[model samples]
Target chain A: MRIALGAVAAVAYAVLLLAPLAVIVYSVSPGAALEIPPSGASLRWYAGLADQPRLISGLFTSLLLGAIATGAALVTGVPAALALTRGSLPGREAFLAVLLSPLSLPGLVLGLGVLTSAAVLANATGIRTAGTLLPLVAAHLLITIPWVVRSVAASLESTDPALEDQARSLGAGPFATLFLVTLPSARAGIVAGAVSAFVISFGNFALSLLLASGRTVTLPVAIYETVDRYQDPTVAAVSTLTIAAAVGAAVLTDRISGPLKTRDSSARSGQPAGPAALEPNR
Target chain B: MDRSRRRVAGLLLLPALLVVAVVAAAPIGLLFRVALYPPGPVAPLTGGPELDSFAGLLGAPYPSVALRTLRLSLLTTVLVTLLGFPVALFLSRSRGLSRRIQTLLIVSPLLMSVVVRAYGWMLILGRQGFVGETLAALSLPRVGLLHTEAAVLLALTESFLPFMILALAASLDRIDPDLLAAARGLGASSARTFFAVVVPLTLPGFVAGASFVLVGSLSAYAIPALLGGSAARTFVMEIYELVTISFDWPTAAAASIVLLLFASALLGGAALLSRRRSARTFGT
Candidate 1:
């Protein structure tokens, strides 16, 4: 009976989780519009996505934004994570909370905050400041950095602080001890955090929705525009590409972090970046 | 080691802190500032006189929108939580290839763009979509699933399920198997062991998962915007439209604040309840 129950659960998950594959099917459907029991199969839509200027540009823009934002997040977040976990700074919890608060707020509010701030800045400066790349990166950095901070912080928590102390006792300077001892030990976490940050930024839409403009559209926003106006399979083709990207990133995360193995360390702790739901009991 | 290192540590955090201040904290402050001011564009430097968006939001469709948001969120929460339980249970118990594949399946949806997933649903749930075709085959007369509360509920539940499942499964995994074995050994039936031993211990997981789902549902814009339609406007939808359509930043700011407060209150209550439970457990 329990086995049957587990099977039922697995089948149910298979159905819900496979929902995205519907896009793949629809993208290839010969029908100009969507059909669940596909009428016929063709690659017409995928062929058309290449010609869609908004989509082509949006793809490039999303990649660029994601790269810059992820770069900013890793550079800042790694150091912040090190200091927070090892530095024993004053008001540590408060600082962590403030930094990670972006993860807590729904992206609607986060993006809107960015939008509002831009409006405020424009108002103050007597300049038209809506829909700029700088705010977009900043907003992405705001949301994406938490992933970096959390993963790196979790790894930092696991690493022995005494390792750094030992290096220091060997007469290494503070900077040398950090570069030599702390950073290398958390290398896996840093790599994992960077991957997570990039993917999170790439997948992010809500923040982009508010920050992106006609010239600076991200893939999600571009897709949003396409779908809002039309129901053709071209959007589905775009979706299929994103779905492929998502799958690749997930596989990458699994491989790079060996996420399942190390999660056992912070599994109980529920590290902020982890999908704690899937962490297995040791 | 102490003074210099501590100072260096503070310096290390400064860049991230500054970005958060400019990006996260200031926008929040601006949300409040312009919300109180007039119903026009903000003047960050030249600040304007206060207006009452809170009072304004209390009137008209804003209240109705808030009500709809709450109803949709509650329904989404209930559905997502129930759906997550089986998945969480499966995840907690499964191992090897089944586990890896299921983990990928469950986690991949979250990484996909909201637009991409929403578009997937668009094709699948549309009147002529697969679900539509399936419904037709079942002899159910044309029941258009798209652009309805039910559709929104379905998609929102899907969107929020990952957060709930992840939280619940992690918590479930932490439980000692011996406790469940002991319950069963003592003649408690499987069901009894589950209810008496499993559910009680995983209350924190339930709270954590439920809160994540609830919060996501409350503020969700993408799934509902795409699947819920213009007619089934959510609170966030109203905020978006207020800015884009009504050209009212003040009202949108106000709406954002009110919605933020509403979500915070609910989350705060959940946190308080969980804390109290923890306190009780520790007190004994």
Candidate 2:
């Protein structure tokens, strides 16, 4: 039974890991035809990406949108994380739940809700918000804030509170103590949160699909449209590039936050560590 | 703890709270209100408030779509859990470099976009793709699986398997080896000890992983749309169609509410189940 289970698991792992690589492999295949094992290797498909105007524009849009959203989330979420961890406020758990509530929402539902809200605002104020970057940024903020809050909060929780108090006692003001003491200690978490926020925003599809106008098309939406219209290797090339970028960011962040993993493990063991606890990109 | 300190904390929290209120909370409230409006041709809320959209959901097609989504999500959850357990077990048992390598293998794909992964499955399962080619090589009739529920299930399972594995691995790592040894020392067989000690201990993780997969699959848009096409119309796809194709925003809002309810119920039920089980296990 154990052997059978192990065999099944091995097959499952291969399928889970190799299927994504199939795209990467196909991207570098020489010909337009997608053969599993290409006759030869070339970067023709990668070069072909340059010819896709929609995809190129979409990539820039997604990058700019992700950057703006990540910046907004960090600016808001880091301070909130600090306050939640160190503020000694009443109803802290309730406040934390409210802040993290967006993580529990389905992207589609949230997207539609925001779309409706934008329509209502436009109707009331005679200024359209849909088909613009405003709604997209708002929706992405909702998605990214919980991640920033959770990551930074988890980091702050591990540090000793006395350090901040000691800094305060040594003539450091509140902001100084926060900047020099609390914020510095939570740098790893801040970096992780920023990466996660950016990645989540960059890869976001359902929300962007609803909120994005024709002019503001994001990469994932563009890829979806391209694949729907034409089954070709260019989409594969675009996907491969994204995969490379995501993996690169993940590795870099993992190296930076390597020491925190050991500390995080003990705190994480007590919880269920659901998708929200991790990064729920979907 | 003092008033001034509390005020500072509130000031710090104001930005996030304001953003959430504007972006998430108000919008959801507006969604519920929109659902109450009668479905109008020109605008969603032109007519007086009525529950017509909610009533429309009880009609044909919506119920069937909801049921299909539920079945698909349930199947995906079961498949992911079954596939995740042994892998999680293997991960929990491994150490050092091997563990890190295995972890990377499991998590790297997760970092990739869902669209990319779904597109990969599309290539593999398309008519001129790997599966069809393999069938041709075997002298068998080529069958197109790209637009089938099975293909969507495969992609969804693959997409969510990492989450299940991670959740289960977290719980499996927490299992006290001493408890397992105690069970074995008490003359329990290996299988007996696993069932008696390990399974119960991992139940919380199982619940967490199961809820995530279930909710995720229930609301999954890209995978089902790409793989299942018209054959497997999920609830989210139905909602999408209602908004974009049908131009029926009220019905779409009502449908979104229904999907939200379904997700909330699953999550709430899982939370209750986990709490009860933990309370019993820990004797709290």
Q: Write down the TM-score of every candidate.
A: 0.92, 0.95
Candidate 2: where is the Cα deviation over 4 Å?
A1-6, A263-281, B40-44, B137-139
Clashing residue pairs in candidate 1 are A36-B130, A277-B166, B36-B51
DockQ of each: 0.51, 0.57
- Residues A1-282, model 1: lDDT tens digits: 668658757765765665698888878989775544557789988999878999889989999999999999998999899889987798998899788767767787778888877776787897766756888899888877777887888778878889888998989987898898998888777877887788788878877787899778898888988887786788888889888988887777666555635454754533223432222100
True contacts kept of each: 0.61, 0.56
lDDT of 2 by residue, B188-247 (tens): 999888888898888888998999889888889999999998999989998888888878
Q: What 10-residue stretch in candidate 1 chain B is worst by lDDT?
A: B40-49
lDDT of 1 by residue, B1-284 (tens): 68887898899899999998888878888888878766643323234656666678778887788889889988988987787887788777777667667777777787788678777777777787777778777877766678988888878877777777777777788788888889989999988998888888789989977876777778778888988887689888888887777677777888888777877787789888998998997794
